[model samples]
Target: MAGYVVAAILLFSAVAYFVGRAAGERFVSANGDQVHSLPGYHGAFVAVWVGIPALILVLVWLSAQGSVIDGLVLGGLPADLVAGKTPSEINLLLSEIKNVAAGHIFSEPTPEIVAASQALLRWDEIARWAMVVVVLAMLIGTMFVARLRLAPRFRARTEVERVLSWLMIACAVSAILATLGIIVSLLAESFAFFRMVPLHEFLFGLRWEPQIAIRADQVAGQGAFGAVPVFVGTLVISCIAMAVAVPVGLYTAIYLVEYADERVRNIVKPLLEILAGVPTVVYGFFAVLTVAPAIRQAGSLMGLAISPNSALAAGLVMGVMIIPFISSLADDALRAVPRSMRDGSLAMGATRAETMLKVLLPAALPGIMGGILLALSRAIGETMIVVMAAGLIATLTINPIDSVTTVTVQIVTLLIGDTEFDSPKTLAAFALGLMLFLVTLALNVIALTIVRKYREQYE
Candidate 1:
């Protein structure tokens, strides 16, 4: 692996050198004007094409070669040595065989395994050398082809820029496709869940008590599939989070964009980002140690019995987590508003506050709404703070100060230990994941739609 990595790096470097030379090439045309673009772009274009495909081939070859070689070597081993083993045992035997070949397996070994190991090592080594030769040949051929194409009107620069754009689009497509793939996979699993527990029961049932008997003789309570209790908890916490984040974050953005001096914005913006940079686990601890206790004390003072792990605590910390999202988006949206609007408002004797409230904010409302959608998504999907701060009981309640669980926390609980793959407990996580995906997707779609409508109105 190390040798392959080193060889791949060298091949990439060589490709880069050649491609750079081709991209920015220039030659005086008949009218004495310089060529349209430099030759470096041409070089880059060839490099990207050559290196990309060959690198892909190398990776595929590397991944498949071991399994192909192993199958051949293992098949050649004596039947008695390989027979009667489970698939996992067969894998273990194969690993031992490899280790023996490499002189690392530390137990008494059968001659058949030793022989198989030797054969595998020999073939693996041969395969590596063959790959090295083929890849080098490919690199050389591509370089030769590129040099042949290096001429006055190669148009390499345009081709390279086009490739770069397509590459970025491919990256974005991958992200979207990955999200879609996850949703599909979860939907499949959740469909299985719905088959076991009816759709209406899972969606509207008010109690969530999941327990299944390990053995036929073992006694267990009927597993209730009602998700309403958790459904309500999730809603309450999310609303509290939004309530906290929106006012504070929007005000912060307004202050930074319309009120604060440049130096304060410079300092404050990074500080808010720093808050966003803090890991969720750290926030979880913050909720458990600081926020949860504070809420409990405050609840006590108010003559209320607030659980240590309550919705309010989780929601408040989540609001802190989401503040950066809204503030940053709001700031950008506010900045994008034309200066003329603020000037016009001011000329009419509107104060900064009045102008921001009446003109700038309304004009930037779509973008602000987009940011809130993003923040809402964050709140919905948050796991750590809620897991730590919200107690793990799914009850149908709307009180923010009561102990309750969210979907993420339940998913985490359902799958945290040694679990059977086919159990309903494990499948529940995927069902919850599907629901979360659909919800977040709906919010994002709405946000984009509103923003688009706002853009058209402005235009």
Candidate 2:
């Protein structure tokens, strides 16, 4: 029904645009050179008026209809059915009522439930139809009013631009509010987790076991929330990945920018960027099935033991995955260097390598640093490859051949089942997330500082 309303509004909006455009054209013919806005602007103004308000109304109705219908149904039920019930119980009862309405009955429902379900369905249908009628009426009403306002003097372009500006503002505000909401949620949950487990233990302790036995009699290890190992593993793997990615990616960019001819650049750049398009899961598979085994075999040949699920395998694969980010950004940055700088250096009798090393690289350092930092963030937050290639042991070892876990892997492990939300185990995920957020934030701040410092020098 909502879809039908939206479709009708869109169809009518098109009609309104044409009608308003015709009206604007008529006004122009009647009073040539007096019309302030173009016919297209008039048409867009009419379309915005006809569609946006009605679309908003439909969205509001859809968001509110279910709750209103549920409340009405619950209110109409017998007092004994909901008398003194807690909010959770009431919610469960509402869920049952909805399930019955949807014909998902597990057993016979009581008469009150049956009657309430029927009322719920009836009210929902009525509300849906009412939404359709109201939206269509609004579309037509706005269409007529907008058409009536069309004249030689109406500033349709200004009105349309005003609406567009407001729309953009709303979108920006929504994004900011969403980010604030996420931070607040993470802070709240992390506080809950800290109440159950000490903050120092979570931040500084050396273990990462998050399992807590639900029953006192059950034999389970006392949960340890120390996150040192997870943090160390994340750092180690990211360092290894950066070690592989930065030099290779930077060199690739240099070759493409300075050495490759037009044909080679055109062919190689796209092929190199194809790495970014490959799914991470495919990389994970390559790590697990191919890279990990190869690493283990190579280790055996060297008379050293290597874990089958090793950090080295995950780090190598993740580095390959992020190569495109560094390569593409660095390529753009290197290419953005002023041609005058290169020509001046060459005119001073400097070799191409000397010119590139001394002039182009220093000039593009800020953008290259930005790309490396972005890739570092991507490496730090990666999960699938780590999970598939690096085992989830949370071992506090710097050895790339050792199996270790990262913060993202731990967060996934902590929240993987039908767990109680209020439990320390589940809340631990939020704590990890908060720490990860802070780490990434710190990285961004450091990157910005470096970029600003170099950008000033280069500019």
Candidate 3:
């Protein structure tokens, strides 16, 4: 029904646009050279007037309708089920009623539940019908007013541009608000986690066993919130990733920009970028099935012990995954260097290698640093490769061949299954997330400082 209403509104909006455009053309014809806005502008003005208000009406109705129906249905239920129940319990009851109403019954419904489901269905139908009627009326009335107001002097373009500018601002504000909301949520939950587990333990202590007993008398072990091992694992993997990605990606970019013929360059560049398009889960599978086994066998041949699920395998695959980021950014940066500089270096009798090493590289250092930093962040935040290739054990070792878990892996482990949000075990995920956020923020600040310092010199 809502879909039919939207389709109708769209159809009417299209009609209104043509009608308003015709009206504007008529006014221009009648008044000769007195017209201000174009016929298209007048059409757009009519479309905006018709569409915006109707969209708002539909949005408001859709947002409020579900809650209003839920309240009405729950209110009409037996007082005992609605009263003195926890939010989770009430939500579960609502879910069951919804399922039964949708004919997805898991079990026999009580008479009260049956009656409540019937009431819920009836209210939902009535609300949807009301929404359709109200939205259609809004579309028609606004469109009519807009048509009556259309004149050669209406300034439709200005009004349309103003509305569009506000929409852009609203979108920008929404993005900012969403980022702030995430930060605030993480902070609040981390604070709750810290109240249960000390800040120093989370940041400094070496152990990271996050299993907590559900009840005080339960035989399950106590939670240890120390995060040092997780942080170390994350650092080791990111370092390994950067070590592999930076030199290889940077060199690949150099070869493409300086040496390769156009045909080879074009072919190779896209083929390399195809790595970026490959899903991270596919990389994880490749790491687990192929890379990890190869590494283990190689280590055995070298008379060394290497874990089957090791940081080296995950980092190697992750590095391969992020190569395009570094290569693409570095290529752009290197290519951004003036051809004049290269010509001048050659005119000064410098070899290609000398010119590349002394001139182009230094000039593009800031951008290269930016690309490397991005790759590092990608490595740090990755979960799938680490989960598949790196073991769940939170070891403090920095050995790439050792099995270790990262902060992201630990967060996933902690949040799985039925979780009590208030428990330190679950809240620990937020605390880990907060620390990861801070680490990344610090990396960005440092990278910006370095990049800015060098960029000014180069510029």
Candidate 4:
């Protein structure tokens, strides 16, 4: 059924594209003086029109089909079976019944329940195919009608151009909308988690130990969810990443934008990015193999209990990963600062360093800050380096010598392997993600806000 729907949609879309293109050609020929846009616009516009409605129909039908089918199936069951059950209870029962009907080993089913389930399942499948056919027919009909008056003076060019422009706008909007949807979904799950674990406790708790067992019948320890320790680990690692990224990145930016010859810039820029191109997993292993042991041995001399997977190991590797991002962005931002500013400062008898630091860097501060904010955000959101290199123990201590976990690391640990979706351990990840998103979002917002407010506007 999915195959049939896919084929029908694709076939109709191609037909629509050809029809629209033909219409556009005729319109351009009939009224060349009347046309205000290119010939291709008519065809592309018609193709978009033909595809959008049917595509939306397919998406909508697919999304709701399963739930609607399940509801109707559950509704058809005998009154006595469903009378005492609330809707949620009925949903659970119906789900089990469907599994039983499918001959799944998870549940048992009687003959009568099986018969009703099969009937509803068949009806649902039929309805889906029926909807697909109807949409396909509508698309073909629209295309045929659009192709009818393809004369030169038909205004097809203008119409097609307008539609194409709006289609591009809609595509852009779709990406933005998807991001918003993801944020909302994460926020909702986090809200559910906060209800189970107090917000303050989760925020300030020094230890994190997520528990499993979704139902009351199963028992597990009441674990701590305080994220303060994990948050500290993230802060520590991000600070280290920035520490490495800033000096190297800014200097690279300085050389690239202000001093480097074109040939040198071309050769050096990609080589520097090759460092960024190294897979983070490789960096993780490098940290564990090379950095962690060294740190642990160094700590032993200082009378500290340094774990092999110390924060410094992970942080240093993460910093290496971020340096390219910082340099690339900072270089662009610095270069974007007007050359006129540099000229003015140099004309006033300033040395190269003075001109750069006082004039160019200041004017470019907003852009540079924006780049730092970008690198900072990347550092915080990083998962693999911390997961593989930073040990997954939540501790309140600030010592970089000790092992620590991050929000991302805990999220990975909490959700890794097999998981029961409703378990606190799994939900704990959503809570951590929520915290991470909010922090990153806040940092980005503040960075942009400050840059905008403090942006240089020299007379």
User: What is the lDDT of every predicted structure here?
Assistant: 0.84, 0.93, 0.91, 0.80
lDDT of 4 by residue, 183-207 (tens): 9988888888888888999887777
TM-score of 2: 0.95
- Residue-pair clashes per prediction, in order, are 17, 0, 0, 7
Per-residue lDDT for 320 in model 4?
84
Which window of ten consecutive residues has the lowest lDDT sum in model 4? 149-158
Model 4: lDDT to the true structure: 0.80
Residues 243-296 of candidate 1: C-alpha lDDT, one tens digit per residue: 999999999999999889999989999999998999998999999999999988
lDDT of 2 by residue, 1-459 (tens): 777888998999999899988988988888889999988899999999999999889888889988888789988999988999999899989999999999999999998899999999999889988887788788889998998898899999999999999999999999999999999999999999999999999889998888888676868778899999999999999998999999999999999999999999999999988999999999999999999999999999999999989999999999999999899999999999999999999999999999999999999998899999999999999999999999899999999999998999999999997767888999999999999999899989988998999999988
Of the two candidates 1 and 4, the one with more favorable TM-score, higher being better, is 4
Q: Give per-residue lDDT, candidate 1, residue 334.
A: 97
Alpha-carbon runs more than 4 Å astray in model 1:
2-7, 10-37, 66-130, 148-155, 158-176, 214-222
Return the TM-score for candidate 4, rounded to 2 decimals: 0.85
**What would you estimate as the lDDT of candidate 1?**
0.84
The CA lDDT at 32 in model 3 is: 77
